[model samples]
Structures are given as structure tokens and as C-alpha cells.
Target: MQQAPTVLHVGWMSRAVDALVRSGAEVTCAVKPADAPAARTVCARTIVVPDPTRSTDVLAGLARAGLAADAFDAVCSGLEFCLLDAAAIAGDQAGVSRALAMRDKFVQKRGVRDAGVRTADCAVLDETGAAATALPSFPQVLKPLDGGGARNTFLVADERELTAALGQPEFTAGGGPWLLEEYIPGVEFQVDGFVEGGELRLMSISRYVQNLIEVHSGGLVAHIVLPPRTHPELYAKVRALAETAFKALGHHDGVFHLEVFQHAEDGEIVFGECGARVGGGRTDEVVERAFGVRLHDVWARLATGRPSGVTSSPGHADDKVFGGMNLSARPGPVRAVPSAGEVLDRPGVVYAEVSAGPGTVLPDTTEATNLRAGLAVVSGADEREVEDRMRRLADWFAAQVAQETSDTAG
Candidate 1:
């Protein structure tokens, strides 16, 4: 029998590591010390690094572990922060370039625009915290070049708001050169899929319950998958957009989580941004349940220079539409919250994870979209049914959670 391929997996995605092992590969994980324990449980070997996001740290850790770059047949990371580092270690110049395009918002949008794709007009902020070009219009967006989860992202409606935002400590302190973009007013949709050898093998699109920008104002972060059969025109547009954007960004092989906007008025699809990794939250779970394909499995195979087992025709196990929700708590001392089992037992609920419960203290501020107290995946026979179930689940969860009263404050 052929010897299993030796793979050096970076970061700490348990699912990806598990997929690599299941694919007959001997996986060696390079992860931060905090994740070493969990990595050991799944990988054949583990190299502890102080920080996986830093290429120097990862390189030094590997050397101390007595391993060379040639020791592994492939190097890959499922985490956003570690993508460029993994590419550098693997000596994949193409991968490095592609990773940069995906990580830096300005570079990403520029490339997509150059490819004749419609995207938000953006410019890089200079050292004085001023846009290098004139602002596109009011309701402009300001965000870190490499930020994720909508953290440090701002929507300034006018000059006064922009001035206030620019004076904020997060912007003034450091982390120079942010990206300023004209906010695209539309319904946001995400396209999740795998591209191999410059060809899109599988694609799935989902519509967000609300735009991500609303998260700052106490909005729930959730989305429902759109079945292709029900929305063929949307699927076609999204698929073409994804393929064009990926090709422009030089991402030939890997999983992608791409965000796009459909103009609220003209209904024209515009590129929002894209990530050369799996979507966040329970997106993988929702996709797998809806389409019967594990994105991580496809990513692992592509990383190892093997053929992705995914075919053009993704066979769905059932006709149920799926969706995911990030459970958030109001700022306070949590008195009680529903258990994961309680949530999973509900009708159409397939998966649930409750991280906040009795005695948990939630912070007053919400900065990121992924700052969840828990998560859940639900399914129904159609989009409306799935959406209704998601809203009901959210309401039910809120009703179950009890916060400490002001009188109880110590």
C-alpha cells in the first residue's frame, strides 16, 4: 500500500485536522501552545508555537521541534490570521500573494475591480488618518485592512460621524493605514464553495438575516441557506461572481467564504469581500447538512495536492433548507440560559452549542459578529420555514435566559 502523505497543518481547526487524518494522511499540527493539547488529541504530532499568526514564531517553533520545511508534503491553515504565515512556510509564492489579496481589504477590492467586478470604491488611509483619495460618498466605511468578524469596522454617515470615528482611540492609538470604502446599500449574501485548478467545484449561497453592520446596534447575526433550485438566477449570478473574484485574487484551490451585495435599487450584484477559508460560525455545519459535503474535507484534500472528492453535482440528503444563528447575550450577569441539549431537542434544530449559562457575565460592549454566547443550526422545508424557525429559536432562547437584576448587584 502507498505510504500516507505527510501533512503539516497550521493553526487549530479540529475539523480540518480530523479530515486530513481521515483522508489517509499523517498530520503534524503546528499550533499555539494554548491549542497544543487539543491538537495532540487529533494529530500524529504537534509543534507548539508561541503565536501561529507570526511566521517567525512558527518557523522557530518548527526548528526547535527538529523539523524541516521538506519534512511535510503540504502546509496549510484553516485560520485567517495564519494563512499568510502558512503560505510563506510552504514557500508557495503564489499562495502568499493570494493570501495577501484575501487578507488586505484594499488589495482585495482593487483586484476584483480590475477584473471588471463591481465592488465598493475604497482607498487606504494615510499616516494622518486621512483617505489617500477623496471619500467616495457619505455613509462610507472605515475598517482595518486585515480585520475580521466586523471588528473595528465603522459606518460613518457623514463628515461629523467620520470625524468622531477617526478620533476614537482605536483609530488614533495605532494600527495605521485602514481601508475606507463607500458602503454598498443592499442585501448581503455569502457564497461558500470550493475552487480547484481554477474551476469552482461546488457552490452554496446564503442570505444574512440582517447586514453585518447592524451587529453593532444589537442585531442578531444569522443567515439562511438559499437552495439553488428555489433561486436559480441568484445562484447563477453568485457563482459567476465568486468565480470571477477568486480568479482575480489568484485563489486557484481551496475553500472560499465570499460576501456580496445585491443593490437594493437596481438589483445588481456587487462584490463585498472574500476569504480563502471556510465561513465562520456554524456555516460548515449548515452547508454540510444542506448539501451533503464537508467543506473541511474538500479543503484538506486540496491542501495535500490531492483531488477534491467534491463533484459538480452536490447531492442533498433531503429537501430541507438550513440556517445558523449566533446566540448573543445582553450585558449583565447571566442568571440562567438554555442548555445545548434543550436547544437541539427543539423541532428542526440539528445542532446547538451553548457557551453561556448561569453565573456567566456578558460584557456591555459588542465588537465582533462572532462574539456569541452560543450557536445553533436549524432546518426546514423551505427558506421561509427555515427563517421563521430561526427567529422562533432566537426568541425562545432569549425567553429562556434570565439576567441578574440591578438590585442584586453587589
Candidate 2:
């Protein structure tokens, strides 16, 4: 009797884990020690990762643990959580070496710039010398050379701010060598899609309501669905740039997330960043709701080299407009809370999820991590209706969460 193809899965992407298990692969889940418990639920076999960002450490540890690469037919990951570790295990040592290039932010930024892909001008800076060196411009953004979800990402408005930011406990402990880029001044968009057999497939763009730098400047606290009604032509131009970027970065088959900026003045698109993984923050869900296809399913099959016998539900009409809007309350102790069922009572609200319930102290608006309170998945007859419903939902969520007092009135 033949055995099922053994697959080694990496990262804390629960969505990918569920998909892979459901896809019928002999899945061995590998993740950081902190994430092992969650991996235990779906994965029969789990490996604890030490330092995922460093390829040398990962390779040595895995070998010392006696987990040979040849034992598995494929290795896979999606989120930033231990993605490189999974990539390193695929096929052979050469595969591990190549995964470093794909996973490192500095390498990806440099690769695209070398290929004339029009990325922001950036310089690599070490923690020791970052403060002394003169930055390219004021209001520059600093991110970990190989980090994601804006964990240590900061916006420096001047020399004083840069110094303070670098001294922060987060940046100091992050072990950097960071990437600093001239903050691209423009309307930002997140393009999420798949590149299969060297072709860009099912590309969609999400526009942010605010800048990612701050609470007021319109950071990623909220975003609208793909193809802004005003900028239809942007779809073509952004897609082309994203395709060129994916190829230049040496990705053949996998999901890709590309953050880009359309200049506020001239409307020219500039590359902000790119990753060889599925779009974070349930973006694949938004994409599925919009187009009726599950990119996650495609990505899982691609990772495991399995046939396209997917069990995910079908998608809706491509023309139908759907919006995935995030909501939150002011920084304070959560007093009262609203149930998901209650939030869904609003018109056009198809689905909703609240992360912090009553009594949960919401994290401050630092990065994407602490800012979001809940998200509403709504479908409307048109963009205006979608926007209105989103606004209503936000207001309703704020009202629902009595952030001021320490106790609920009821």
C-alpha cells in the first residue's frame, strides 16, 4: 500500500493549518515554542522552532533534532510566524538557502530595486549606528530588516523622534539591522493575489483609510476593499508592477502580498514592500468574499503539491461589492461588550468578530497589533452603502464598548 505524501508545515497560520489537514496530507506542524499548543490541535506532528529568522540556527537545530528534509514530500508556511523555518525545510539545503533570500525584507527590497522595480530609496542601518547616521529624509519609516505586521515599524518625523524610537525597548530587543525608507507620501494600497506557473492570478487591491504611521494620519487601522471606485485604472498598473515584483523576487508559485503607494500628487505607484506569503489579517477571507475563490485553498495545495480537490465553499459573483472594515474603541479598559450576533444585527453586516470583549484592556494604538478592536464583514448594494454601513458599525462598536468607566452600567 502506498503512503500519503508526508508534508512538513511551518508557521502559526491557523488558516493554512486547517486547510492542509483538510487536504489529506500527513502534516507535521512546526512553529515557535510559544505557538506549539495551537499547532497541537490540527497537526499530528509538531516541531518547536528556536530562532526562526536566522537560517543557520534553524538548519542546525532541525538537523540536530534528526528531522531530515527527505522525509517529507513538501514543506509549507503562510504567515510570518516561522515562515522561513518551513521554507528552509523544503527539498534540500539549497532550498533553505534560497528561502533566506525570499524571507529577508532587506534582500527583497534590494532585489526589486536592482531589477528597476521602482521601490522606495532605503538604507540598511544597525542598532548601534542607526542614531548617528543621517537619514535620507525627515518622516522616514523604520522597520525590522526581516519583520512583518509592523511589529517594530516606526515613523520618525525628525532626528529627535528617530533617537527615541531606536531606544524603545521593542527596537532594542528586536536584534536589528533595520530597514529605513523615505516615507512615501501617497495613498497606500495592499495588493493580494497568487502567482502560479509565473502568471499573476486573482489579483485584488485594498486601499487603507489612513496612513500606517499614526492614529490620526490614517494608519492600517481600517481599509476598504479592492479597486477603489475612483481609481479603476489603478488596477491594471498596480497588477503589472506586482507581477514584475513577484518575478524579480524569484517567486514562482505561492501567494504574495505587496504594499504600494500611489503618490498623492502625481498618482504614480511606488513599491513600499512585498512578502512571499498570503496577505495577513484575514485578507484571503476578504478576497474570497469579494471574488468567490479561496486563494488560501490554492496556496495550501501549492505548498503541499496536492491536487485541486478543494473542499472550501464557492465564491460569489465577481461584480458584487463587499467590504471588510475594521473597528475599535479608544485606549482604555473595556467595560461593556457587544456580541458578534449583536453586531451582525446591523444591515449589510454579513459577519463580525470582536477580539477584546468586556473587561479586556485594549492595547494602545501603537502598531496594527494593539489598534484593532473588531472587524465587520459587510456586503452592500454599492460602495456608498458599504461605506455607510461601515461607519455605522464603527460608531455602534464604540458605543457598545463603554471604554470610559471601569464598570458596565447594566
- Per-residue lDDT tens digits of candidate 1, residues 156-245? 888888889988999779886788889899999888888899988888889999888788887778888988877899988888888888
Cα RMSD of all models vs. native, in order, equals 2.0, 3.8
Kindly give the stretch of ten consecutive residues in candidate 1 with the minimal lDDT sum: 127-136
Query: What total of clashing residue pairs does each candidate reach?
Result: 0, 7
Query: How high is each candidate's TM-score?
Result: 0.95, 0.85
Off by over 4 Å in 1: 1-3, 315-318, 405-410
lDDT of 1: 0.85
Candidate 2, lDDT over the whole model: 0.70
Instruction: Give the alpha carbon lDDT tens digit for every residue of 364-406 in model 2.
Output: 5555543577777777776677777777887888777877453
What's the residue-level lDDT of 344 in candidate 2?
A: 85
- Which regions of candidate 2 are displaced past 4 Å? 1-3, 31-38, 47-67, 91-94, 127-135, 167-174, 215-220, 227-232, 306-319, 369-371, 403-405, 408-410
Candidate 1 residue 170 Cα shift, in angstroms, is: 1.1
